[model samples]
Target: MNIRVNGEKIELSSTVKVIEDLLVFFELQERLVIVEQNREIVTKEEYQSTKLGDGDEIELVHFVGGG
Candidate 1:
């Protein structure tokens, strides 16, 4: 499937069907991060149920801290 990530076109396996699936795909499900899909904020609770379509936009932001 083809989707846009941060405005960049990328191809991923069909197995990725929902927003939360990305967590498993990228091995970040356990990591703390924020995800916005098509400009809408996606909560962790909704990630698994949020279905993704072609041409959809997905933005992932991970939290980082430095001293």
Candidate 2:
């Protein structure tokens, strides 16, 4: 399936069905990240149940520590 991530187009494997899976796909399961799907904020609890669809607009923001 193809979806837009932060304005970039990308294809996701068939195995990615939910938000949690998407995180793992991008190897971000262990990082501090925030996800917004289709203009709505997806809660941590919803990651497992929130299904993804084609053409869905997604925004992924991960915290980076420096300074």
Find the candidate with the highest lDDT and give its number: 2
lDDT of 2: 0.95
What's each prediction's clash count?
0, 0
Lowest lDDT sum, 10 consecutive residues, model 2, at 25-34
List the global CA lDDT of all models.
0.88, 0.95
Clashing pairs in 1: none
**Cα error of candidate 1 at position 22, Å:** 1.2
Q: Please report how far candidate 1 places residue 66 from its true position, in Å.
A: 4.4
RMSD of each: 1.3, 0.7
Give per-model TM-scores: 0.87, 0.95
Off by over 4 Å in 2: none
Judged by whole-model lDDT over C-alpha atoms, candidate 1 comes out at: 0.88
**TM-score of candidate 1 to 2 decimals:** 0.87
